[model samples]
Target: MDLRSHSKPIEEFNFLDPAVLDNPFEYYRAAQEQAPVYLMPETGMYLVSRYEDLRQVLLDTETFSNNLDGYGMLQGENWKVHQGILQERGWPDLPTLNFTDPPVHTRYRRIADSIFNAKRIAAISDRIEELCNLIIDRFIDRGECEFVSEFSFPFVGTIISEQLGLDSEKMSTFKKWGEAIMAPTSRVMTVEELRENAETIVEMQHFIAGKLEERRKEPRNDLISALVSSRGSDGEELDMMELQSFMRQFLSGTYESVVTMISHGMLILLREPGVMEQVATDLSRVPDFVEEALRFDTAVPGLARLVTRDTELAGVHLPAGSIVMTRYAAANRDPAKFDRPDKFDIDRKDKAHLSFGTGPHLCVGRLLARRELVIAFRTLLTRLKDIELARPLPEIAHVPHALLRPMKELPIRFAKADAA
Candidate 1:
């Protein structure tokens, strides 16, 4: 592949373009090779591509802020549009975990920390394994299946919905709602897209608020009840709005990313002949393979932060309120950080990938996501024999988004294995 053909002059580069979304590493490499830090002409935001620069920015929260107001997607006219739309309807802003910094972030993170604690992660291990088998069972006899929509999407979406005490039967709708709510925050959306997303968010919020009220009236052994009944350090229960905000964060965090991780991991293995066989032969390596897949092609490739004060990083002076975008995909593949950066090797000792992000904003659902992938792959390899792509490999493309990179479809065929 001639990388130069894909390269655009720094002034013309736009990560949201369809070509870049197809292979962002091309632009990431161009940016890194040209300069570690360069101002993006499309949004007037600085792009940080080097691993060290990105790591320092992520850790230096004092200088780099995660306030939603400064998020790259919400910057420029997007924020004004969003605020105006919400103000028109008199809606309250639902402060999400990803959009907040420490102290406040600490408080919100604590509210949901118990739900993803060691005990909870361990307790759900078996459930994850069971769900993997059940999901496979649905399409096993079909001989061929669309892995993304039919398998990965529903598998992770249903688990998240179930965890939130939502109707599992509505998993498809939940997937749609998740997409809508995340659109404006994750990428550049058209005015129509923004309006549709706002409407979907309002509908989802009403649903969550109703659930909160139900849990308040008659508590049950579910996440909504758990959250409603949860007491803070001050021994006060979380209010309805807080619960709604947390629920939005929970849904956004897990829904698309989990499915993307699973589908991408599998796609990586399948694309590389014999790698799948190597992992399938020794299932213990599945976890390491998953990590490498994350490095090679992360789900959430980049995130944005606001420059909080006059600061100089990598010799580039940045003023307060400037938006900085950290490219995790670029960082993960930085040759300065990883040897043979583009190669996927499970045996590599250096596994410090930025796929789950870093510093205070590391994904809270990291453990659950990893466990789901490992269990899903383990179950898949055990029950499906001689698995191979049901369609031409080149035909497989990713859903175009500014943040997420998930397979559009993965039609796979396999022979059902005998009872183990």
Candidate 2:
């Protein structure tokens, strides 16, 4: 394959560039047009954009390893400091279910499935709905709210914290620790930023380690106890390091993507005229609308995989150890896969999207996420009357990152409901 025909000059593409981060579809369109697979020399990443190609890569996990070098949570410079701190404390490298390949991945998945199964989720549906209403009650009377900080973060954060058997006071601390741990993966940071992030990483790890010991001594019904006591098919429990690894992945996965989906999904309804009113009038369409919102704008845009062996993908030859990025956001909007790809149509016959990914490494918490979104919108529609944007669309903005596109704030107004 002639590389010249597929992509413009290398100078034309820089994913980290602010312009690209703001709107990546144009770049995805160009890449898919020229070459479904294009090598980004600056970042040493082979970006796979088209729907079919990305889908193939996701399914062909044998060729692509989940554990990509220099791409995990513990990647880059600052993490080295974090690694040293962990080693000094005798903690092993925290590799989670998402960061491993087969056998190990299989075992971890089974363990995770036991807890995040249909039975467990269905049992909690009422509690989740009750929690949603409780959260809304705090702000519903005000007739105005900053949805992200006031509701999205704390609402989801508190639930996840409770599941993990953490103290109520630890909710805010989790966000700080999450930012500190994930910031390094998104971009280059200053020395001060790196140091601060490393320090927080140590703090969070210490806290979790203590909880692990507590669960070991006196098991409870929460996820922490499950991690401490749950046995694999072989009837063996994960060691402390393994347990911590699962905790990191579970906590991060639970809070970040779910919050992004909920907050951004609402933002989409606000931007698309009449959509909110449509859902408000007819509650049945809420699920479809949420699905469309996820497809239209995925929270986690893409994920990285390391090429395990010399291989060819979409006409591009990739050497072993190459970093390949599967762009789920781009794949979700591929014209070949969906008609009028850019348009947000809830009634589209084919609603299958890669927002939660595909194949073996697909997000384990997807069911929980979908349920949360549905209940959130349902409760809002029932509790608040005549919902509308509190501020102009232009004022609403997003914070860009390499891994995600999250709204910065979402201000909205609505009338409170009568006491039931």
Clashing pairs in 2: none
Report clash pairs, candidate 1: none
User: How do all models score by TM-score?
Assistant: 0.92, 0.92
Candidate 2 residue runs with Cα over 4 Å from true position: 1-13, 69-78, 393-396, 417-420
* lDDT score for residue 152 of model 1: 94
Question: Residue 220's C-alpha lDDT in candidate 2?
Answer: 82
lDDT of 1: 0.79
C-alpha root-mean-square deviation, each candidate: 2.6, 3.6
The Cα local distance difference test for each model comes to: 0.79, 0.79
Candidate 1 residue-wise lDDT, 1-420, digit = tens: 544335666556676677778777778878877878988876688999999999999998889998855322553565666556655652556665767888878877886787677777787788778877888889898988999988898889778877787888987679878887667655666666666666777777778877778878998755667788887777887776677667877888888888888888878878886788898889998888888988988988877888989999899999998989888889998878888787778788899999988898888989888888888888888988777889875532876766677778888998987776
